[model samples]
Target: MKAPSTHPIKPATSIPALLKTAFVNALIALVLFSLMIGIRTEAGSSGQLTYWTRFGDLASIVAAVFGGSIVIELLRQWIGPTGAEKLVPPAVQSGISFIGRYLAPALLIFTLLVPVMFYNQRYILDLAILVLTYVMLGWGLNVVVGLAGLLDLGYVAFYAVGAYSYGLLATNFGWSFWICLPLAGILAAFWGVLLGFPVLRLRGDYLAIVTLAFGEIIRLVIINWQDLTGGPNGVSGIPRPSFFGIPLDNSDDGLAARLGIEYSPTHRIVFLFYLILALALLTNWATIRLRRLPIGRAWEALREDEVACRALGINTTTTKLTAFATGAMFGGFAGAFFATRQGFISPESFTFQESALVLAIVVLGGMGSQLGVALAALAMIGGFELFRSLESYRMLVFGMAMVLIMIWRPRGLIGHRAPTVYLTKAQAISSDLVKEGHG
Candidate 1:
């Protein structure tokens, strides 16, 4: 005979209790949102400060927050952290895979045709170029942060290295962009190795601090090395890229002239778009190929458990250096492209903010996810562009969105992680199965 369990089951949250909690949460949100959005300040006609209050804004925020709180409460009761398995079902995984196959080609084709589709709209084309640039940067950082599980807060140092390398080489030697691109990557990779050697024993916050200091050191050096780096004035008159050695200017030797067509500014813009697109594609392709190699597997193993990886006889030194070098190489390429595109180089462009944004893209996209990186870059950058009109509330909205995303998808937007090496048939793994950056 079996004995019945003596423990009592917990009772469900009462409706009144749920309502009370929601109301309290909404009240707190109302107070915070009111302070953020209810008041406005501007210069008056008499050159004095003026203040305005919007009751309507407060009411809207209260209602929205109240509604949001109620929904969150219900969701918490239904499927909290303990119910993670419900978040990623086998059916959902299959659907995602099905959509991915078609979505990738469709996206590539759309991106390829964007300049042509909006040929007359230079603004849109310019935005596309900016998006692709970030995508390349995100992919590059993913190698170190996502694959290698190295927290690099000074990635922009490598970016600056590449940009300055190209600028100095081109301005001093009159070298073309094509010649300086690879050289820039090499210089940046060398710096990456140099940085990697010293931080070989460090991890976590220590490693992050060292990388951050490295970035600041590079910036300060650039500022103080006025004779060589031009200090704050920066280097200008850097050459623009050419089409197979054909210049893009209005001269007779320009591509527009050589093609027997009247030179339109659109020609240069189109060429720049394709050039960045090609670079971004190359970055993505290389990352995908690398993930299947032995080194790549070693990176995943190291990311999951460094001690265990060393126990298995993996050389952590070479692995770490390779990750840094690979990431720096791509960053350098992007930096050189940026310099040539802008026809200028400056330390202001590579800042901690730039590193943060790249890191955000890697984290928000889901660490080690190539497709997620591209999608996240488009979302974050496009969101910024879209909300530019809401100048005052843009950051508040962006911050709120990020918080909500973290709450909803803590791991990342595309939270599922595909297996590095499957013995039998491969399948997407739930992010809940392991911490990020692990296999």
Candidate 2:
């Protein structure tokens, strides 16, 4: 390790020293509260939200900055350096450990308990289902953003295509849900390819702008194609999911009777919970498997350095197409599931905000890290939900929070430790034998 003296603490310096400085500064900021209150007292107007008024905002900003600074200093002291230089636990192997250690048992136990839990407590069950659905979406997006390093801003379009496709197919052609489901995926995949062709040469900001435009175009089409999509009125009374051949309606021989449970509307919620939970797990497993494959390696290589990937003879075109297709497929699946859950489909549901939310999950979680994506999704999505009860100021607080988080974590929540596949330990050790002998 380089001596702390090598870069001695001065105007800018060591982490431990930084932490001590931050702690001192925070105390100073905290002591300024008396002056903040004085300013607020003078700035308070005849009719305005004290919180929204300039004085209140200054106080809040000062508090948030100083508070954030103290926390940042603590973290910096604990985990020093920056960029790729900062050490982190490996994403993939650590994800395996996390799932095998905590998530698997938690899922199994929750699955066993939710039936009883829902019977007694329904709202929590509903929230659980929503979280699971988003988790599925996040995992699917992970395949595109995390592993492939593609930035898609219009992902919600695939979702819309899936939902609307299912809605129209089932309503118009009397197709089965299963049939419509796969058909929806195929339609979305087709659109994904359609999108892939135009933006084949684009990356970074150009790619993002193109995708954002694509998403808006899809939403506009849905809005303009009023007759088919039901316009802003939305398609209601969409069919719910079913077993192999039986529906979950209030019929004589539906799921309620089979499970020996009384029929309440909540049974639909329970069914959805299990369905989404299963889908999320499936998405996770498939992504893990794909990352170990040759094509997956090509995607990661392309992500890190497209020119170098080309040098290695990997076809960038095929890699990009596959990434788009895989991500769109999952988004479509989510759309179908959402339609089934709410029994509704509307253009409003597939807005840019939804795309922004999913993209935010990918970034906040750390690019190319599956577990990080899931964790980030849960934190950000659930945090948004929690803030819902904050009334008119909710969005204000939420936006500010995002700004602060990005400032504090410029790279991401987990930074540069993206997951990847490597040789087995025995192979690694054997390869290192000569180097070890030289050392």
Candidate 3:
């Protein structure tokens, strides 16, 4: 018998094949960007529609696409289809695992020091607060999408509910932030249950469609119900959160006066920073603790295989309802904070785009991984601000970056799924072992 081959055969790289692939990609790009990029339309001095051409920019983009396609094709040929993982050295894998082990604690420590480190920088403080807001939102959605394996396209509906709940309550009844906070959450949870009842029987794309419609419906209602939601003009002059009933203003009754310290606007900013920080920490802690409980595990099981979950006698209905209610409660909490932080809110603030961004954060961060979601939120929210100077090219760069990340890490930045309960020792489970869930 002939001796077995010592190594696997590699596919031959052909110049013609590479060129062909590049040409096809470049042609597609040319067709797509021709109208979108090559032509710009605007209302001119005469108040009529005007158009201009930017063929140079269009040509440049097509060329870039051509070059990128060829480079990608060459890399694919060099690495071989099944050997992409081999590109990562064993030592690098070990280092990644090590970083993953301690990253959460390190991030928490750094986050706590943010206000002190940049105490005087108002811009940084505001940006940090924005990042933390999304972090809280991500953590809330993580419970539904990441842990419970439910796809929620109408999450912004609950967010709107919470904001409007607080806006209407505080504006009409003159309620304090502390009192409205819990009420906002309770109201959102009620809406969540209302949403959950109809969607309990649906899964996958059908569920997504229904939830999306629900979000649009809520926005429409808000727009048409001018008397209550203030129509498109939005609710304004919402009260800010006080330091336990003491305002942060320069008035004699304010916190600064009470403490015998000089009043400055920075105090309010700092207070708001720590307030959201505390709320985010509560979300993180609650989620971690919940995962060990029976209900949490049931949610996970339902995420993995609803059929198997039912076979094991799990109450899928209650499991799903609790997940929705729990997620919506945190979303409501964040919404309340948002309204108080901005002192205004409108239906425009809670849109499908917001839902998509939060969902992208959860998916890009890796489902079920809190640290991953937090890190993803920072990158996405911060990255957008980082590219603000790019203006026109900002979205192009962002889209490219997202595509590259997905290519390199399709399962997400941190794809490992740690077991809620392990026999010998707790271990990180590979993405391959985790199911993406039916719902």
Which candidate has the highest lDDT of all?
3
Per-residue lDDT tens digits of candidate 2, residues 98-167?
Answer: 6545864675576657767667577778777777777778878777777777788888999899899888
lDDT of 3: 0.90
Compute each candidate's TM-score over C-alphas. 0.86, 0.76, 0.91
Best of the candidates, TM-score: 3
**Reference-based lDDT, residue 165, model 1:** 92
Error of 3 at 98 (Å): 2.2
The candidates, ranked best first by TM-score, are: 3, 1, 2
Query: What's the lDDT of the predicted structure labeled candidate 2?
Result: 0.74
- Residue 291, candidate 2: alpha-carbon lDDT: 82
Alpha-carbon runs more than 4 Å astray in model 1: 1-87, 420-424, 437-439
Worst 10 residues of 2 by lDDT: 430-439
Pairs with backbone N, CA or C atoms under 3 Å apart (clashes), candidate 3: none
TM-score of 3: 0.91
Tens digits of per-residue lDDT, candidate 3, 369-413, equal: 899999999999999999999999999999999999998788888
Preferred candidate (lDDT higher): 1 or 3: 3
Clash counts for the predictions, in order: 0, 1, 0
The lDDT of each candidate is 0.87, 0.74, 0.90
Candidates in order: C-alpha RMSD to true structure: 5.1, 7.6, 3.7
